[model samples]
Target: MSYPLRRRLWAAALILGFFVLWEVLCLALQVSDLILPRPSQILATLFSRMDVLWPHILQTLWTTMIGFALGVIVGVVIGALIGTSRIAYDTAYPLLIGFSSIPKVAVVPVLVLWFGAGPLPAVLTALAMCFFPIVVNIATGLASTEPELEDVLKSLGASKMDLLLNVGLPRTMPFFFASLKIAATFAFVGTVLAETVASNKGIGNVMMSASSNFDVPLVFAGLFILAFLGVALYVVFSLIETRFVGWANRKSDFAST
Candidate 1:
């Protein structure tokens, strides 16, 4: 088989093996459906309750995508500014680190209070959760640019704008995309958490309701949906990265093997 086909088959086998092991363990332990439902049980519940769950899932997805886009825009703009300026980097870097260190979850209540218990709060929560990683990744990538390259650009009398557009931006593309994958996952988590705390609509609300009603299987189903969404977003971002950063990906593959 070709390498790509072999990789696809391997991925399928891995997933199948995982489910088989999970099913075996659950059966052998006779795990209670209330405490830990098997994958089959979760899948069954998900399908059976699709009508109830689909709207909530769509709501969460909408908030997540909006917040993620906003966060990425803000992050890239601020990151590029800081990355390109030594004074700005020194001045803003410490504050960025300090804010990023603050537990993002702790701000959920404040966001709800400020934005009210709706999509706005949830979107803001996701934006806050996702922004930091992009900034850090872009800044790091910018700082790590080869000094020789900068020297060469300077020798060629490249303007600051030229250097930023031609060299700095391209170098930071991989980091930007990498952070996007991380941020997408975080954005989902943040939106869900905000929904759990404040909103009547969203997957988190469904999960919360399931928990309160002691619907263990349903709770697991909600979790499964969230996990699937995160994976889907990650895969989408990875495809984007592969398309845009083909050279970087090829280099990475070569380094690894």
Candidate 2:
């Protein structure tokens, strides 16, 4: 069998084994549905309530994507500035770090206060959550450009913009895409967090309501849906990374093999 297929098969097997073990343990222990519903019960809830859940799922998905896209745009612009200019780096990087260090939970209420408890707050929260990683990666990537290469390009009369367009951005593709995968997950965290606290819709709110009602299975179902969406985003970005930055990654793959 091909190595990639074998690897995927192993992953699928492991996931299936995990669910099977969970089901068996739950059944054997006779775990109460209120405390820890079995996988079977969660799956049943997912199927039964999918119609009701669909709109919320869509809300969360689009909110995260929009926020992630905005984060990428803002991150690239600021990152380019910080990466290319010492003044911007020294002046802005520390503040950026501080803003990122603030717990996103603390920021959600302020967003709600500003935006008044709807999808807008969720979008902004996701944007804030995903912003730092992309900025740091893009800045690092641009800054890491080989000094010798820069000198050579300058000797050849390459302007700064030309160097950035021709060399820096391409070199940063791997780092940028890597950050996307991480930021994608963070985007979800932010959206769900804001949803639970500020909004009346989305999976976070659904889970919150379910918990309040002592519906453990529904809560787990919401968690499963979020996990699925997060994995989907991660996989999408991974494919894009392979498509654009595979040359940069080839060495790592070769070394691993």
Candidate 3:
């Protein structure tokens, strides 16, 4: 098998082994189902309570998708502008760093007050968490463009727009997609955190309610669902990345071969 295929197989085996070990330990220790439910129990709870969980999952997914899309759009525009312009980079980069450094969760209350405790706040929270990585990655990609290649473009009498479109933007595609994966994860996390803090309904609300009633197994079920959703989002983004950035994958394959 090729190296990539072998690596993938190894990873799958490792994950399966880890889960098997976890189940064995849980059985051996006879751990209370409440404190540390086995993976089987969590899976059982998930299936048993699917009807209750699906709507909450949908709500969270909607909010996260909206937020993530908005964040990526805005981050790409802002990052491109800042990265390509020295003046803009110097002026806005520090401010971007400062804002990104601020604890996003700390602003949840203010977002609730401003946007009210609903999907709006949740979307805003997700946007906030999802934007920074995209901006940083895109900016880095733009800035790291090969000076020699840029000079070649210039020598060909390329207009600023042409340079940006054909060179800068293309070079940044991989980094943009990389950031998208991270942003997708953050989008889900941010939505859940916002829902937990204050929301009418969501997976976070369901999880919180379960915790309040001491339904530990249900809480684990909720968490399992969240993990599944996060992985799903990441996989969706990866597929999109692979589709849109096919040249990157092709180049990688050529190099490996």
Q: What TM-score would each prediction reach against the true structure?
A: 0.91, 0.95, 0.92
Clashing residue pairs, backbone N/CA/C < 3 A, model 2: none
Model 3 lDDT at residue 205:
90
For residues 54-116, write the lDDT of model 1, one tens digit per residue: 999999999999999999998998898788788999999999889878776788899888888
Q: Which stretches of candidate 2 lie over 4 Å from their true place?
A: 1-3, 251-257
The candidates, ranked best first by TM-score, are 2, 3, 1
lDDT of 3 by residue, 1-257 (tens): 89999999999999989878888999999998878888888889899989988899999999999999999988998888888888999999899999989888898999998988999999999999999999988888889988999899899999999988888889899999999999999989999999999998999999999999989989998898898899999999999998778777777565544
RMSD of each: 3.0, 2.6, 2.2
Q: Is candidate 1 or candidate 2 better by TM-score?
A: 2
Candidate 3 lDDT score at position 10: 99
- Estimate the lDDT of model 3: 0.90
Q: What do the candidate models score in CA lDDT, each in turn? A: 0.91, 0.93, 0.90
Q: What is the lDDT for 193 in model 3? A: 95
The sequence of per-residue lDDT tens digits that candidate 2 reaches over residues 1-257 is 99989999999999999999999998999989898889889999999999999999999999998988898888889999999999999999889989999999999999988889889999999999998899999999999999999999999999999999999999999999999999999999999999999899999999999999998999999999999999999999999888778888666664544
Candidate 1 lDDT score at position 221? 96
